[model samples]
Target: MTLFKVLSYGKGFKGQAIWASVCSIVNKLFDIAPEILIGIAIDVVINQEDSFVANLGVVDPKEQLYLLGFLTFLIWAGESIFQYLYMKNWRELAQKIQHRFRVDCYGHIQQMDMRFFEDQSTGRLTSILNDDVNQLERFLNIGANDILQVVTSVVAVGAVFFLISTKLALLAFSPIPVIILGAFYFQRKAEPRYAEVREKAGQIASAINTNIAGVATIKSFTKERHEKKRISAISDEYVMANESAIKISSAFTPVIRMAILTGFLATFIVGGLDTLNGDLAVGAYGVLVFLTQRLLWPFRDLANTMDLYERGMASARRILGLLDEPIHIKDHAQAENIDLSGNIEMEDVTFKYESQTSAALKQINLTIKAGETHAFVGQTGSGKSTVIKLLMRYYHAQQGQVKMDGVLIENINIVSLRSQIGLVSQATFLFNASIFDNIQYGNEQATEAEVLKAAKLAEAHEFIVKLDQGYQTTVGESGVKLSGGQIQRIALARALLKNPPILILDEATSAVDNETEAAIQRSLKKIADGRTIILIAHRLSTVVHADQIHVLENGEFIESGSHETLLKNQGRYHQLWSIQTGGV
Candidate 1:
């Protein structure tokens, strides 16, 4: 859908838009009146005794001139006032639309299934949120107002021309059809070129984002030169795409200028000849000449306008495409509420990532009673994290139901279901914010004392206290200011502060040093005392004390027993332990 049409659905802005458009059109009409006035002034100066105003009603030339001055002041004032009004309305509307669209897009992204994120890269998503949204904003800020004024200029000038001199006006307006047709042709051709430019820009954004995010990896591998060449290639493609569109757009104004000059010259030569032949008045000839420029000069701006529209339309398509993404996994209307007591069950579960893919999980069945601690140990690509993701309702198993306290998870409202579960993953992400803010992010209502308590439990408080500003210290982008162990601890503290009845720590201690891991283990033991804990870890030491351990491989649970019992079985878990710890 077009931006205006998409935005028109907002009943709240309809009246404002109408008022703004009315003011805008009226302002342009008044703006065109000055050229008409200039023609009338010439009429009065050259034919004072028999001017149109004197012949009509005001026979006194001095009174007529004063009346003209009054009208001139009114016209100028009206143009200035409405100019301000339209600008204010257009800019404010642009801001509001941008804000609303960005929020809606972000909210939709949040609701999307984890599989969507797993398959997509962070850099690409960043391009959509930042670059795509700004493109729409830039269009609305300027293009909408330009189009309105163009339409107003055409209609208002055409009406005045028809009233003043039909034949001469017709001659002057002759080139309009040709100009408009040419504009449409250029618009059609330039649109695809601009779309390519926008796509290339998105790729550029993705490449830069990926490189910055993986700077450490590039440096470690001594691949900066290779990375630079890759980035340069993408950047060059972006520049070339823009240049292709620019070449076409630059040609537009010159061609339009030549067409507009044809009409201007027609008015100048024909109208002057008519005046000399006494077929038209001098002032009338002047009006036709001056109005010709007023009518056609704005088309010069069409190059800029068309350029803006193409960029906006290209960006709009991408933004709207994101908005149009179907919510395939919808919440049930009559969904039940999940109890705080976390009695969870997965029954005969099976799931596939997409329609064409084989099941990620098959015939999975398990149960965890309230306040029990369970763990899963597995190799890479074993679908261990996938289980936690399922529990979090990121994806629904097609074949079987997942239950929380006898209420099917699909039946529970997603918000409430999530509120009761706290998850800490191996890749712990911390926002660029104060240490205190990051810790309190999960539980915004948490008191400072409560935040400190959680931080202390996760062994994050000690390092935080040692920082220059203690809890108030800023964590650089993605917690780059802190070490991996520190970021993990802070993330753990954030989850701890949430104090959910159900906690899922998916390899939460995998990145930390042994000393930090021991501290986290102590914290985990204390926290797991009264909560339902599902620990998914490749680190065997972390889950050794769990009440039960499930060894998963290729999405299936191959062994289930106490940690010691699994070790005694001499199976996959035992083999993993031996390989990892050099113990038999």
Candidate 2:
């Protein structure tokens, strides 16, 4: 059933599949023709002038032999030609399907909601896209053709058997039912075992990925042996799962071999007797003997083909299952891109993460006017960043409307909505690329001069030009070669390059030194004139000059006003400032 589902999913390749299958069947037909020709050759030798070929008017025995040789050459050439055709078509079809599935699956994942990623591991996804897709590709390349050819061999050979002698044919084919039943039994038993094998494989992949990503932590804690043991445990489970599947598949070969031997022996002994008694022709008997081996020998490969089939189906289940995952945050049917002017408002907004019992933001009402600077100061986990997330539509608020320039956020296209906001978060991420490329990522079409201007404004150009390659220097994975302060500056430069109407600095200066922080602040002052700036920070000094400072506690705005007014009230803001500034 899963195979059928995969086939249907690949219905787009129906024409290719059909052509490949036809070639496979024709190839097998040609492949078995030599044995039939050898039988006729024997008839030409024994009957001489009265041979079957002679009856067709080629009375000379030597001429019949010559004719057989020529025909043999043609049959071999046809077989070789079809073999090449089938292999080419099957492999090409497999490659196209494999490519399409991976690209489409990745595209689907890119559109998934953030919460979907929270529930999945990077290693598991990697395994499905790489290992699992390759598994299916392996089946298409070889196993699918094997299955089709085997059936063609049976039908074509069986017709020849019955045409020569029905009684002998019936005896030769008697063992087939047993082989079929055994194959079905193997499939039923192997399905769950192979599924377990694939599951264990994913677990091991996840374990290795986690260990590699956290190798720094493991080394710092001196937990090398512990991590090795952890990975070894996962590897052992994978082997055990494979061994369980192998047991059933291995037993299949010997059982089917015995059944095939029965068929071979039946044709050899019975057909030989009929020939000796003159009831069957010697050439006909030769044909039966050779064709019996040809038909039954291939069933020996049945176990291996079925193994591939079950494994591929299991992988297909995972691949299709991922594709079936609903996109929970896609744009509405009527969603359209709209020009925005950066004014943002959240009215009675409340939100709770699915994993948490308590609300992250509660009864929040906020107004951010265009071309003004506003700051939110709160302790960790006090919902300061949650507001920024909601504004960016990363997660929707469950109980209120987030409006941008008088339009409900959900009504605007998500790409258009996020494109207008430049976010520089505390946890900055940089791709492994040149500094110029990383900074230019925020605006793909930005010219070199524009990038330099933004970098200078973010106070990053002075440090960058001192490096060996300047803007051309490669930042290792996640910008590992750069210091935290430098990485933050590059991230800031990227956001600045966008020149968005709304700029959000979510603790963007947290990692820099005091002098660097002051430089960033001065740059921000220049850029903040005509853009809506939202600041979330723990350093109360950063908000001292804001047009409005709102202090949050337990997801509620506890104090709101200018920095001077909040300090005058001697509330939460005042306490935080006193602690940071060493004041009473």
Candidate 3:
């Protein structure tokens, strides 16, 4: 699978490839013409009247010499022109393919399910998209060009050598089989080594990305030295992997050179003997000598070219594999847009994560009527978040149906389905942009006035306006410049701006202070009217006013009632409520 199959991608660029190859071959032919000219000039000098040029009717020595000079200029000029054309063609193709492929690969990735991201690392994905694609670019830029020229040189030179002296040509080509076998041997061994190198590179990138993102946590825990050691260990593995590939690939040139030396020496000795015996013309022998070196010297470049090829192929395998990965959450063929009325239902739903052995949600039936607020309370790992994920179609249920209004969510167009739901999660993520931009992220076309209105509804406008630049203040990476309350409120503003019929807030206020939580609660009450709100909160007080409350245990709903009824029943919800309120 790692072996480069150029036919896979090369088919599309057949025209460019054909022209590039033609340019390489024709340029090489013109380049070799000068060597032939040198031999004929020698013929003209030694046997002016009987020279090969005399047959062409340039009998004078001076005239023949001048003709060769003129021919040299023309041939060199042609060589330069074609060299420029081939390099430009090949390099332009590489750049265009790289840009187009990156965009296409990213588009495919955007359609994959949430589980795909859970199984992949940010650093590893970044490495593949940026590093791996760039590796292919490097190879395509010049490695392919080198390979084409090498092949053209061999075919063109071999014919000339055969014409001058067949016996000597056979001796010169004797080591070719050995050289071919050696190259194959090197490729076979280098492939796995390079694969390991690429894997280790991803690991290193993942480790670095983790460290950078968690630098604050590292300093908080005083684990700076420990993190450095951990990163260094991963980096050492990368170095070791590269070293293994290098050891095998670096030996290729020296061994090929030795084989090339053998053939070169044989040709020199045999061709010289033929000339001394007058069996071969001296000028013809000169052409063979020059052609032999031109043919073999480039084999050294072959080693570097193969190295690039193997590395690029290894990266390509990973990239292509990702592009071919199955999309599990795509809309069904019969899917259609639904005019959502905010009513939601989960009927006998059961679901399990692909990596988990047990079901995350059992046979649970639930409903939230349009404009009604419902809350789910449970301890950690009680599948609160999984419920939200299912309703959004971030995952699919293994059994039963999840419906929006009267239509099955599975039969709804995925984009339309998601567009009907607005979500504000516990961990709020904001882009590095102005506060106005972050608030308007969910609705890019929302006017600045609408953004400000949503911000005020989320109780974020007060603090935003207090800042020096007000709405235009930039929130650094992940909104790091903003406090937890500010981040959550801004996220709420974004969700509200979308103004979907269904809103799900999962532990949205858990991390904020009591004062901020109270402010958010007021905003929530204001926005909760005329919309279906599904609340998943660890903070018991936040759900006190919810229309209905359900206590979830394991993967099933153990209790369901209004807040007053749950407390009166003295069940699981009562137990949690008592602990938080200390029985008031």
Candidate 4:
């Protein structure tokens, strides 16, 4: 995914890009015509009896100047027209390519496995989507056109020089190879420095985003000054990185300038002698001098143009590398979309996280029949929530099988399977939208009355109506405007609106206060009967009423029975129960 690949991806715009480049070169050709006109004006003044213009039928010198003036107007008008064209075409091309990059990159990112996100930082991804795309936009808008025109100018002018006088042309073109070599050398050195600068930019963006999202934690810990110092350190690193790139880019112009001077001096001394010795026309000699400067001067901007190119290529590689990564989870070619029963089963399932040495869930096997309320309780890291991940197929089980209604989950269409399952987790995340929008997210097709019904069933309507804007209240980022209990209930309302055949509530009420816990428990009792419920919790008190409770210890189910039956057995569940109830 180099700069060439970035361009190749825009083959959709190939015809347009080609035309825009053509316009740039054509405009420069006309722009350089005025210098040639100046040389002819000199010819008319010095060789009045038989000048080039006189040979074309305008015998009078006065009339020749007037004719040259008319041609000047036409040539300039042509230059202006193509200049406008190249500018519009190039800028629009930049916009189209940028749009393509963002849409394709983001769409691909969404389809990648959940494990991909775990290994990447939000800020770094944001940098690629926004900053990297913009970098390519800038280069496409102007840098590309400038580079093409500069090369055209060199080629066109070099041909003109050689046609007039080969010996003098050699002098004018002597330093061109050196100037080119210097440019390549600068690119080789600036490429990696600019790449480092881009990395620093992502780190800085990540630091700022993390701090803003966790402002409350910083405030509670009273670490504003410490955070500022950390942010400043990151900012300093970004500055130093840019400084390194600047050092290389800034040297390009001056170095190329020396080469330009060498070309100019050789043409000046040699061409001046040729004219004085009667071997060259004074007018032609004048043209060579002006054209030499025209050809060499623009190479100065080659520095800035290459600067943009290097930065853009670095960004393109990162963005394209992300797109190149293969997606691990995909539906089978013939996966069926069928209705699911509430029954669920896990048969000898063994799962391990990529970062862990041991299995998170070792040889776990369990089942929940239709319309059953099952609970799993265990210590943290005991794989209580790992079951939910397995059920959702967020990560594939390393061993064994998970099935829904006697059908292997891997054979079911992912979209159909997820649509039938509803989950409300410990960490509730709501969009930056109104309360109504968040709830409606579960079933976007749900009517207003259906949302209201879902809210009432979850016991959230009473408090929602008291808010200043009622259902219209916007939840700040991640619903930060609401309390823990309010957020949890809203999440519950969202899941209830989905009306899935299977529901998983993982630590759903773990963070709420005693009163809120009682309220959620009451709501749970009302809605737990019609579907299969899998409740994973760390608090033993909440699951005591489940129809069947399982005690998970070190990734294995140590005991399972009705709540009262397990308590009577005095097993692990009973010990956890006794501790919560103060050994009653």
TM-score of each: 0.95, 0.96, 0.97, 0.96
- 158 Cα displacement, candidate 1 (Å): 1.3
Instruction: lDDT winner between 2 and 3, please give it.
Output: 2
lDDT of 4 by residue, 299-395 (tens): 8898899999999888887888889999877798988897887988999999998988989998988888988989999899889898898888788
Alpha carbon lDDT of each predicted model: 0.85, 0.90, 0.88, 0.90
What's model 2's lDDT at 205? 87
User: What would you estimate as the lDDT of candidate 1?
Assistant: 0.85
Summarize candidate 1's per-residue lDDT along 293-314 as a digit string, tens digits: 8888888898898889888888
All candidates: CA RMSD (Å) = 2.0, 1.6, 1.7, 1.7
Per-residue alpha-carbon lDDT of model 2 for 1-584, expressed as tens digits? 77887677568888988988998998898889889888999998999998899999999999999999999899889888889989999999988888888998999999998889999988899999999999999998999999999899999999999899999889888888999999899889999998888888888888888888788899999999999998898899899989989999999999999999999999999999999999999888988898998899999999999999989988998999999999877799899898777899999999999999999999999998999899999899899999998988889999989999989999999999989899999899999999999999999999999999999999999999999999999999889899888898899899999899999999987776787678778888889988999999988777788899998888999999998899899899989999999986
Steric clashes per prediction: 1, 0, 0, 0
Lowest lDDT block of 10, candidate 1? 1-10
Q: Model 3 over residues 268-333: C-alpha lDDT tens digits? A: 998899889989888888888888888888888888998999898888887888888999888778
